[model samples]
Each structure stands twice: as C-alpha cells, then as structure tokens.
Target: MSAARPRVLYVTDLAYPARGRRYGDEDVFLTSRLREHFDLALCHPLDATALMDAYDAVVIRNSGPVLGYQKEYDAFRARALGSGARVYNPLSGKADMAGKQYLLDLSAAGFPVIPTVDRAEHLHQLPAAERYVVKPKAGADSLGLRILPADGLAKLAGLADGTVLIQPCVDFAYEVSFYFVDDDFQYALYAPDPERRWELRPYAATAADLEFARHFIDWNGLDHGIQRVDACRAPDGELLLVELEDLNPYLSLDALPEEARDAFVTALTASLSRFVHAAQGTQEARETLIPA
Candidate 1:
C-alpha cells in the first residue's frame, strides 16, 4: 500500500475584487498546480477554521485583507494556536501578520524602515516631509489610510488612543519586492513607475539588494511558507522596508515568465512537502507520548 498524500485545506477568496490584479485566476492556477502533489481543497477564509481540522495542513493564499473578517480571523488564529493546527506561514510572524506595529518597532530599532510612530510626541522621530501618512494599526490594503500636512498632526492626538499608526510620506525612485520560499530567494519583481505599483516587471536583484532583503527574512525567522519583502529605492539609492507580508501575500505569479513561474511552483511544492512531513512527524511524536 502507498502512503497517503498530505491533505491540505487551501484558503482563498476567489471573488475578491483586488485592484489591478485577478485574485481568482491566480488562486485557481496555484491550486490546480498544487493539486498535483496534495489532496487539496479550496475554501474561503471565513470557512477555514471550521474545515481545517479535516486536513493535515492549511495553506492561506490570496485570502484578501483580514480587516474584512477580523472577528473570524481572530477566532481562526486562536483555534489554530490552541489546537496546534498546522497553518502555513505559522502564526509566529512578527511582521504584518500581527499588524502595522512591526513598522514602529523596526523603525525605532533603526532597521532602514520608514520611520513610524503612534504617539504624537514621537512625531519628531520621523524625517520632515511635506505630508505624513496615517493609517489604522490594524489596517491593510491601504484601507483607512490618509495623508496629512503638518497642521493635521492633531488627528493622531484625537484618536481614542493607540488605534492608529503614523509615518512620513517617503519619496522613492521605485518600488521592488523580493519573493522567498522559506529562507531561499526565488525571484524578484519591481514597478519602475512609482505611481503604478501593480505594473510589475521581472527585476534582476543585485547582491546588495538580496542582502538587504535577506536581512529581514532572517529577522522574520519563519521555517516554512512564502514571504514577500516589499521595499522602495530611496533618493540615496538604498532599499527601505515598506512592508513584510507574511500572511496571504498575493504572489504575482502571473507576471513571471513561464520558466520562472514553474520554478516558483516547484520551490513551493517542495517547501509544502517538507512542512507537511515535519508537521506529521511532530504529531506522531506527540501521539506517542499520550496515554493509550
């Protein structure tokens, strides 16, 4: 008899109307390819927690912003953690998975991120700019984001308290993203035109670029799953962190050439296999310790 293939519950919102992207087509393509390796089933983010127990692992992909279903997402996280459910990307992420708080933390540590602060007193910490960007700490997808002038700093003070985050608007030459499978680099994409972030093209990453991206990946310390390091090329020609997306990051697989796309799928498939086997091993070990 052959060993059973790992059963995976893939979470996605196929109907999500993402700006400048096709969430459905991307997820469909990925799940189709993934089905070749696992016993895969697709479900919406709201339904994942209910169905996750039936599978060996849950893979969250293109699920859209959690803000839309914050209550359900919180429940899913609590249950997954409580049950030791195998969630790809694991819940240990210290970056965007938690919230925009990581930006403030990273900025204070001088990690080449755009300076961020939640309190009005710390506004001086950020470099002076014509405008500042303010958004909710728990926000995503540019939802609830605002740009304000110096006189508009009062908005941060009137907030019920720590419910928002603030950052100075950065003028960057362009935006680029580095995609990684686990700790390994797979490929890179960039938007040459700053005004059009989603018009992406394949970018050949330099050694210094990779080093800069890897620094954050290393900081994240995820042992499995895909991560995207979003950065901008500053006026001084240095990369600065824009966001570290570890949760349901939209992989622009459609933008890649066939060869690169296939390579990414291959890398992801291998990573999932390893992650499944590792989770199975841990479960078996735990079972052995339980009283019969």
Candidate 2:
C-alpha cells in the first residue's frame, strides 16, 4: 500500500461490445465510487501487465473475454504471479478463471451443478436430455458454445482430449446470480424471463438461496475480492449451478436499487482495503525478518 492510500490499477475493456450490457458504464460508475478510497487508474486488459507494477493491487473489472487476447492475459498472469503482485479475485481461482473444468469436477462430485461430462464415454454420466450444451474449456462470454442433439455425440469424441465441456441442456425456469465481496453476500438479481438473460431485476434472496450460493463461495476459498454465483431454477425447484464467475463477473448494477448498489460499492471498497493492507503487512514482516 502507499503511505496514504492503496493504489489500484483497475483493468477493464471500455469498448468491448458486451451483449446487452454496458461494460463501460458500470465500470465507470464503480471506479468513480472506488476513487474515494484508493488512488486508482484505469487500463485496458492488454495494458494491464505493463502498468500493474506501479499499483499496490490490480482490480480486474469488466475486462471482457480473455479469448480475444489470450497471450496477453497469459503474460499478465505470469508476470503478476512471478512478481507477487496482489490481484483482486486472486489468481488462484478454480472456477471460470481457471477454466470450465470446475463445472465437470463439481458435477462429478454431485455438487448440484448441471451434470457435465467432457468425453463421449462420459455421455452416459449426464442426465438424459433431447439436447446438450457443449463449450470450450477455456472459452468465456458464451463464445464457442453450442447446443447439440443427443445423436451428435459422435462429433464430440474430441472432447476426450479435455478441450471442451458438455452438459445436459437444462430446461430451467429462470436464472439468478448471487454477488459476493470476500465471501460475504452483497445482493442478487434474477432474470424472470429465461430468454432475456441480461434483462435482470432485483431478487429477494431467501435463506435457501443464500445457502446455495455460499457453498460454492466457501469452496472457492478466496480471502478477498468479488465473485458471482450464477444458478438456474431447475424444473424441480432446485437451484443448479450455471456458472461460478470469479473472474471479472459483471455486476448488473443497473438493475439494483440505489441503496443496494451503494452497499455493494462500500463492501468492495472495504474488501480491497483489507486485501491490500494484508499484502502490505506480509511484505513488511518479510523485510523485518530478512538479514540486514
């Protein structure tokens, strides 16, 4: 941390044309709010590595899909890890940050996720459905996603190589997402209409809903940063995990009430403060213990 306040390098892609969402607007709002607590600078994802070293921590917001610049992202990740730079959402995430492998792992472990299988042989593992969803393991923003008929399994034999993920197409009623900052629940929003995923409305989360979301957050084990747990209301009324978005999960702030949005910003500000201070403390301790 700086002697006065933490310096945050906020990574975002202001011009990325996200479907039905204003990536620039939300980030503009968030950084404006965060500026109250930190010395902040905004940068595009492609420029993150070159600029990251000057800041105490890097906050990756709506940076858009890594598929657009995988090599640059890989380089940023390598440099951040090697230099011990504090990255919000920490680079240790096991979910979407790492890849779609977590969905397969969670499904196999019977974690209430949509049953997923990666290979032709594993097709029998998923629940029977007329159609299935197949997507690349490393893809994001629904890129490379496909809905295929059951008979199309032959074409997916390459899935055995672990480059892709397949799940039974869930006939869900609606989708809801729970937002959290450092393992604490912040707010939730749901899309009442299944077709309009980005048309969200504020959701009154129940105890059961919080319980469902908390399980994955606890499993993720991130001591700091924001996370979003996306789940769908299955036909039987159970909430099955759709995606655990730990990397730059877009918070539909526009759908939230004023009070709720303010509260989320407060929560994030405090979380970042704690995260930066902790990293600073560790560094100070190391310096103290070093032989002078």
TM-score of each: 0.96, 0.97
Tens-digit lDDT track of model 2 for 193-268: 9999999999999999999999999999988989999999999999999999999999999999899999999989
Give the true-structure RMSD of model 2.
1.2
The C-alpha stretches of model 1 lying farther than 4 A from their native spots are 155-160, 290-292
lDDT of 1 by residue, 130-225 (tens): 888889999998999898886776765665267788888888999999999999999999999999999999999999999999999999999998
Best by TM-score: 2
lDDT for residue 226 in candidate 1, whole number 0-100: 95
